[model samples]
Target chain A: DAGITQSPRYKITETGRQVTLMCHQTWSHSYMFWYRQDLGHGLRLIYYSAAADITDKGEVPDGYVVSRSKTENFPLTLESATRSQTSVYFCASRGTGRGTPTQYFGPGTRLLVL
Target chain B: AQTVTQSQPEMSVQEAETVTLSCTYDTSESDYYLFWYKQPPSRQMILVIRQEAYKQQNATENRFSVNFQKAAKSFSLKISDSQLGDAAMYFCAGAQGGSEKLVFGKGTKLTVNP
Candidate 1:
């Protein structure tokens, strides 16, 4: 309960439908990231936020949208979910400016788009 | 852009034995961080170990240790006295010093045979 968590552990949606995956962390970490894991392609960063109001795109940000209005919540939205978007999505958080830059991840959200 | 590569897609090790998973990376930046993550069937990403490029000494944690070759741009994880609980998908990831994004390699599925 103290670490990061993701909502809707599993979801099924149709193509062209809009869906959102919610990620929340209790640690109030300064750095939060969203990654999608697929077969043959490990984990690719979709988006990352340095702070509440500061966010940037990562390797695979196309067709995915993210916003960080609050430090604890970073939700990923798929405006038009496609079949290729079906994968396990993960949310991670890490504190910056000290120690090891290790990231703690939450239980992934398995999304299936038909 | 930095790229991490895990050559072995799958590996099997007998219980109480040792297993090594290889990982190679390509990065021009001198200072960076490397990490090994373990994901079990539960789909939670757990940090196994970490090594910084700036440090010449290898990093070890309990049964897990990394043979980090800075000159070869290679990082491999060696798990000693492997147990059944160690059966999972292991991933290699890297992040630049000033960047919040982490580049991950295709994971290796390790099976423990008892």
Candidate 2:
């Protein structure tokens, strides 16, 4: 697809296990972000990358790690998944510089930890 | 840190009618941008509209428009001629000019009655 896409649309994992969600965008947006959506809490930024090799943490970055080795790819990893980590993950991207800062999101990955 | 707040958790409107979803955001940044995102049951985050802090005119896209009050830090979305397809969860998000992170509200679930 030409837009952002996430792999493993749905996943089931056990506690203490590791899981990774992949995100890819063809827009070549300079900024890529990951967010988790939970009940009551709409969506919170998990991590963001300004560019390849440049990443930063967001409000809820604990227990989650992200790396952006390429501008088109930004993957999120949960080293040891917990029950509380069960949520829908979203990947978004936007162009940089002087332009519309509106971000476009992926279809989302639903993760369930048992 | 910038925070977005959505007071309405759920709203219902008859098809062909108009409905407004309210959103409030707090930010210390001088220049920022606010956005409205629609997430249907498919879990795809679709950009509905956007407003820049520096622009006095409210942004509109088709049936969707925003009443952005920059001074009050309030940004609300008005969906005119609400259709059954408009029945989805609406989220408000904000990002500063130089920041790559986006803060999203809890979201409001809108239901359209046909």
Candidate 3:
């Protein structure tokens, strides 16, 4: 079903440069989220959107921006990438069914900031 | 704010044995959700199982199951008949009612030995 997909599965960028990771889902889920996985730090939420135009800052939202212009696409942008920003980024989505909170995750984007 | 914790940094289980990965969380919300995700070397985050706070019965998917204790704020995953495919980093995550943002644990690296 290609439940969830991410673009540029791998990327390399220099410090102070801008980078964007793209996520798309086929389920048309009502919620979309961005997370970065790092050693010892686990996976930290970066940003999330409740719907097409409703976005909110997550625990690690600083230095990052997100926009959900469409229900299936949620893109995460790093204004100025830093060495600390080098991590595996994941995107996930969930349907709006009541009492159901299972999230479907994408393959993830591996970003390397030099 | 909620916090998830996985105290075990690594765990090992025999190919035909059972293993339990521990996870605990702190949250004031009475209605929240917990999830267990598996990430292999391929970096694909796969949902092994999930539990809803209101459900007393633990969730199970094939050989995977979860022990959900709402009062204790504990959600542990148990894998029976472990196979080589079971080797991966297992993550525990949580989210408040109706919230799309998730808090993740540091993860437990599982090794399935033959």
Candidate 4:
């Protein structure tokens, strides 16, 4: 309960359907990130939020939307999901500090699109 | 833009042996951070080790250590006394000192042979 958690550990949805993956962190870290892990592509950042209401696009932001209404919550939404979007989604949080700030990751949500 | 590269697609090591996973990166920033993350079958991304660019000493955690060559832009992970639990996908990542985004490499799948 003291770590980050992602909802819908496993999801299967049809293409073109809208889906939202939730991420909640109890640490209240200032930085939160969403990443998609695919074979041959370790992990690509989809979106990140520095703080409440402050979000930025990451490497692969297409077809994805993210919002951070609170410091502990950052949700990623697939407005129109595609088969290509099916992958393991990971949410990570990091505190603002020095000497290579460590990131805490949650058990990823595996999404499959048909 | 920074890019991380993991050339080895797969590797294997006998139990209790040692294995090294290679990683290379391209970045113009002088100050940054490097990390190695392991993902097991459970799909949980866990931090293995971290190295700061400005630090001359490599970082180690338990039996996992890094051979960091700043001039060569190489950060390789060496796992000693490998165990069955060490079998997983290991990813190398780089992040700028003050930036929130992390650039990740294509992971290397490690297999521990009996």
Candidate 5:
């Protein structure tokens, strides 16, 4: 009752469209993640990658696809963006090297579909 | 299963004052790591501090420090000499020992008033 709780933040999307949110990190962290921030649900992971060319699904991976061709870039594509898919998408990266456990995030993409 | 909690929806402080954002987490892994990230109006997530579960000492970065209570599963960030630039959204995250996938909080928006 005293810490962080998911409140109602919102997103938007068209019925059937494709939207790609791109995340790029300059630090070249070996791990990258994609998350969607919403009210009540909080920040839900869509996908993550440990390195270039390797990826895995997170808690909520449906309607979303991720790819990592380079260490610095991780992109999230909503194959068919429904109105429900409209939300704030974040890209994050973290290094595997010593003294690096925090995942730094990209400027979130605010997607609005009408 | 993994979970991170930030109960505060928003917090306000004056410039030059100190503010602490509370976070808590749950994980099966004993050797986990905790993190605090700041996202300004720019929406870019910046690393604030990181606390490794293996270490007894807390983590510090400049004016930022963490109050890591391992037994309590608490990782709170304390920002001393808060500046106007300190106004932003702060998020708490947790990662397991070797898996490295992160579980995040909904976030708390910090407002630094002059």
Candidate 6:
């Protein structure tokens, strides 16, 4: 495919278990982001990567860890999943930095922690 | 910190009619970017339109358009000739000039009625 793709569209895990959401983009964008969507919060950025081996925390990165070992993949991991982390996670990519490029998003991953 | 606000929690428009979703943001940065994203039941986040703060003219893509008011710090989305496919949750986002993380608003659920 030529677009961004997310794995495990639907996931259900225990509260203390670890879960990882994978995001892969074929465009080889330099910027990749992870966002969590909830009912009243809309979407909140969890983490973002500027390029390979360069990542930063976003608005809601408390329980999530993100790593970008390559330009095409940005994976988000929840070390100890909590019920509060149950939400839909979205991955987006852009060809360049902010203010000069458009972001393309992938199909979200719906995670449920019980 | 930058913040995006979408006051309308929900809205409905008849098919073939026009609908506008209001969005306001708070930021001290002069140069930035604004965006409108659509998420349907499928959970795919799709970019609808984008506007740069420095640009005077509004940005439009097919049936989607934005009314950007820099002075008022408002960026509203106007969907013309609304169709059944337009029913979804629309989010307003803002990105700093040099930052890749996006600050999103509490989305507006837009319904296109037949």
Model 5 chain A poorest 10 in a row by lDDT: A1-10
Q: How well does candidate 5 score on lDDT at residue A63?
A: 94
Instruction: Please provide, for model 6 over A1-114, each residue's C-alpha lDDT reduced to its tens digit, 9 standing for 90 to 100.
Output: 669999989999999999999999999789999988888988888988989999998888998888999999999999999999999999999988554567788888999999
Using lDDT as the measure, which candidate wins?
Answer: 1
**How does each model score on lDDT?**
0.94, 0.92, 0.91, 0.93, 0.81, 0.91
Tens digits of per-residue lDDT for model 5 on A26-85? Answer: 775788988887766667888999999999999899999989999877878888887777
Q: Give residue A72's lDDT in candidate 5 (0 to 100).
A: 77
Measured with C-alpha atoms, the lDDT of residue B31 in candidate 1 is 83
RMSD per prediction, one decimal? 1.1, 1.2, 1.4, 1.1, 6.3, 1.3
Cα lDDT of model 1 by residue, B2-108, tens digit: 99999999999999999999999889999899999999999899999999999999999999999999989999999999999999999999988877878899999
Q: Which DockQ-derived CAPRI band holds candidate 3?
A: medium
Q: What is the lDDT of residue A52 in candidate 2?
A: 97
Which pairs of residues collide in candidate 2? none
Name the TM-score of chain A in model 6.
0.95
What is the C-alpha lDDT profile of model 5 across B1-114, one tens digit per residue? 888999998999999999999998988778888888787877667777778899999888999999998889888999999999999999898888777677889899899999
Deviation (Å) of A98 in candidate 3: 4.1
lDDT of 4 by residue, B1-114 (tens): 899999999999999999999999889999899999998989898999999998999999999999999999999999999999999999999988888888889899999999
- Tell me the lDDT of model 1 at B21: 98
Give model 2's docking category: high
lDDT of 2 by residue, B4-25 (tens): 9999999999999999999999
Better of 3 and 6 by DockQ: 6
Each candidate's TM vs. the true structure?
A: 0.97, 0.96, 0.95, 0.97, 0.85, 0.95
DockQ of 4: 0.77
- Tell me the docking grade of candidate 5: acceptable
Interface RMSD of each: 1.2, 1.1, 1.4, 1.2, 2.1, 1.4
